[model samples]
Target: MLETLGRSLDSAIRKIRRLPQIDKDAINALIQDLQRALLSSDVKVELVFKMTENIKKEAMNTTLQKAKRKDFIIKLVHDELIKTLGGKKAPIRIKPGKKNIILLVGIQGSGKTTTIGKLSQFYKSKGYKVAAVTTDTYRPGAYEQLVQLTKQIGVKCYGNPKEKNAIKIGVQETKKAMNDGNELIIVDTAGRHKEEKELMKEMAVLEQKLKPNEVCLVIDGSIGQQAYNQAEVFAKTTSLGSIIVTKLDGTAKGGGALSACVAANIGIRFIGIGEKIDEFEEFEPTTFIGTILGIPDLEGLVQRVQEAEVMPDPETVKRMMRGKFTLEDLYQQLKSIKKVGKFKQILAMMGGGNIPDALKDDAEKNIEKWRVVLDSMTAEEKESPNLIKKSRKRRIAIGSGTDYAVINKMLDQFRQMKKMMKRFTQMRQKGKGGMPGMPGMGKGAEQFMKKMSKDFKF
Candidate 1:
């Protein structure tokens, strides 16, 4: 999502690797490059300067006795940048109370209504009884938009277009939601310019009336520094507890939202990565820094993999490790992987690099092909792929509506992966094994197998 800035930062960090030392001159050059990149990405000038200055000071003062200069510089930059982007993580406060209220505020065209819908959907998925309340009496379509969105999300919405009193409407909706057993009520206010004192005052009244747990300022990422200014004005007028940057998909200049967080002295709790309700992501500084630096954080990926449910038992894992992995295990793995989301997203979450362009383009098609091939297999053949005779393979291929070559390719890939796992198990047994680029003893595979055994049943 931060692909542009990520590429720029990755390139800048790579330059450090070629430097002889982290002297002042080298550090200054790197800082200059970073400043230029941030400025170009629409980050506020003052924020960029502060960030670069911190980076420069840290890089120049870092000792290289225990670590490489490049590694130190990268770590320093990552930490400082995260600090500048609001060091502490912030989460929405949904305490055990009568009704937790989150009031969303933003200028017109900032996607406030859409964000409310998305938030409702997000909370609904988490098993919260959420309802959307629109107090936007200014715009004609505002109430309609919110109503349609809440209905689409299958959540209750409270609004009355004819009600001219925004504060009264909000109070009534809050009471109704509470009486209806709604745990969370997201109030969508009319979008107004931060400069509009009257509208800002109205927002304050609504806040006082609703006593919202969170007053989230929704800023448009594409507006860049302008959005920061808007956030600043809003913060000056209201208690802006959290920030939510929207329209982050594609080539949006989102860095300004980070700058806004610094300017407004608020942490970003959620970011809109796409139009879909499920596209919001909670901000994690380390992961965000890793993603921006284009260094896939294998640790994060390993955690996600650990969260996934793989089939079979300790005996099965041991058998697979011993080169006896069957199609049954492969089928189970496929089902688990499918639960994790799209292949590309799964890879990204695992700190895997960008899929090759050709592979990326064909990933969905490949997945479909695999699903078809798996579906066509007989129960006996799937349990023991080696039992599939050539004639059975032809019949299965015909049944799946895919060519025999595609079937053969799937089998070949499965065999290759199984062989590699077998070799890894042997290496572990001989005290000479580990996954390539994996840290420590090649024990992660064994640990992963053991963990899977506990979590999954055959």
Candidate 2:
């Protein structure tokens, strides 16, 4: 989601690596590039300046004994950015008392209601007796939208359209939920524009009556720098504990929301990537930084992927690394990868760029087609792709409900990968000589790959 910013930062870091040393001048230049990148993304000028200052100071003062200069500089920048966003993660306060109320506030089209539903699902998944209540007496469809969403999530929702008293509805709903054995009451209020004073007053009254444990402001990542202005206005009316940035799945300027949190002095609690109930992710600083830096934090991604399937055998990975990767092994790898969501995200986590715009749709179709083709192949065929001739291809196409063209494409891709692996194996056997166009391919690359190969044999 922060693709632009990520790329810009990566480029800046690459330039830093060319410098002779991490001196004051080099650090200042790096900070200047970062400032330009943040400003180009429409971040607040003051915030950008402050961030650059922090990065420059940290990079100059931090002690680096054994690490590479570039690595130290990148870590400095990452740490400073985290500090600007919020030094320590702030979690939503859930009291031990009877009913812990959480009130959500935001402008229209800010995803306030949907965030409430997502939060309710998040709590419900955590084994909390959670219920949602709509006190949005102003908007016509507000109550219905929340009601339908809560029902879809199988959570209780309290709303009365005829009642104009939002405070009374919030109080009654909280009381009823407490008596009904609900420990958490999430109040979804009507969306009000930042300029609406009357609506703000009403929201304040509801907050006063409910005495919510947490007041979260939902923001749209696509709003860019405007997210900060919205948070400022909302924070003035009520104490906002955290922010929930939604609509991160598309081409939204998500970095702006990160900047907004810094400006508003609020911690981000959750990030909504899609409309699905499971799309909400708790804010994690290190993993987020790792992703933005184009470093595959395989440990983090593997945990999420593991939730969908049993862990792949370490022996299987070792076999593949040893150049014995077969179609059977490929099938198992695909099954593990598919659990982590889309192909694009998986590739990005592997330090690859986004799928080419023209190939994005085709890539998804190819994945679906490949799954069916693999399912149709026999055990012997899967163990050895070379055994698949034209007749086998035809059989697989007919069995999988796909065309011969799809089968041919899958075989072509597999052959290309096989050729690359064969070349790698040959190079590894050729005494540690550096191969042409091979990254880290000298003795260092070979040693690293060999170590990884051995380590994967769990």
Candidate 3:
């Protein structure tokens, strides 16, 4: 969704790279490129102007050292873009051992109920006893939807389909969830704006009665320019303490929604990247801008690895780094990577670049094919891949429903991986930590490691 804007921003950086020196003409051209990108992404004209002015002022005032002028200018532009997106990240402050009442508000069709499920799962994984309360009496099946969502995430939900009062339901649910040892209670409210003025008034009264710890406005990213008006309206009704932008993975106006929130002076607490409950992520302005500017979020990738339960323990990694690994271990690692997600997505995150969807799909298919071949291997063959002779390869290929050449290809890859790991171990022992250029490590691994260490601490 933000790919178009990403390309434009990258192009602006390219303009700077082509310059022989940082001069007034080059700065103007870069600013103009930035302006066009932001405006095309539906950012407010006033906000874009202010952002470009700030960038130009800072770039012109700062004198650069000769050795790394290009890098310094790129970093300057990156920092300024982050500032336009909210300056810094503001995470939700959940109170421990007490009910953290988070009231969700937005207009209809903003994916509020689904977001509640995602939020519950996110907190649940963090060891919080989470619960959901639905006060959305205006929407049919709202209560049932929350009930099912809570069930799926193993969180208790409170709602009464017969109840007509939103405030009463909220109050009752809060007490019930609190008594049941729920540390977090997420309240889902109705978003009916049939009578705009009346709806806002009702919401204000509900806010007064509930006095939630946080009032979060869920904005649909697909709404584009209307996001600002929606957020402003909701903010006026209640204290819209934070924002969560959803449906960012689609061809939505994600750039528009994010920039609109910034212009409205609302801090974004989270963003929904996909429909899955696990696809939600906390909003960080700098990291987000970095990703859009072709800088991958290595930390975020590590987090996802942990979340997917695919990251090996420190001991396993240590052993592998020391060159003690077999085909069995290689198969296990492959399984873990498969569990992490689509190969292309992970690769993109590692490199801080985008991959074509077609290529991603093709890579996924190859991974599955390799998994089949691995499955066909015997226990001994897995532990000692050298035992797989031509006859054994044919047998395994028949079992895996693939050609003998495919099995041979898989074995070759396994051998290459072992070789690469040995090289990695040797390099580390020699105190050459980075992957750098190495025989059998391949250009892909070298490129990946280079991009990873660009901003990664370890």
- Strongest candidate by lDDT: 3
lDDT of 2 by residue, 1-458 (tens): 56777788778877876776777777878888898777766677887888788777767765433224556667667766666566545666676546699999887777888888899999888888898998887778888898888999899988788888888888887788888988899988877644599878877887898889988889888787788888888899998888888886653367777778767778888888888777888878667766776656535443533332243355754564477877655444444444543333322322233434444443445777788888999988877889999888888989999998888877766665566556656765674546665443456545545544554632
RMSD of each: 16.6, 16.4, 17.0
> What's the lDDT for all of these models?
0.73, 0.72, 0.75
**TM-score of candidate 1 on Cα atoms, chains taken together:** 0.61
Model 1, range 117-138, lDDT digits (tens) per residue? 8899888888889998999888
- Clashing pairs for predicted structure model 3, backbone only: 296-352
Which residues of candidate 2, in runs, are more than 4 Å off? 14-29, 57-67, 95-97, 193-195, 297-458
Better-scoring candidate (TM-score), 1 or 2 = 1
- Please list the residue runs of candidate 3 whose C-alpha ends up more than 4 Å from where it truly belongs after superposition: 18-24, 296-458
- lDDT, candidate 2, equals 0.72
TM-score of 2: 0.59
When 2 and 3 are scored with lDDT, the better candidate is: 3
Point out the worst 10-residue segment of candidate 1 by lDDT. 341-350
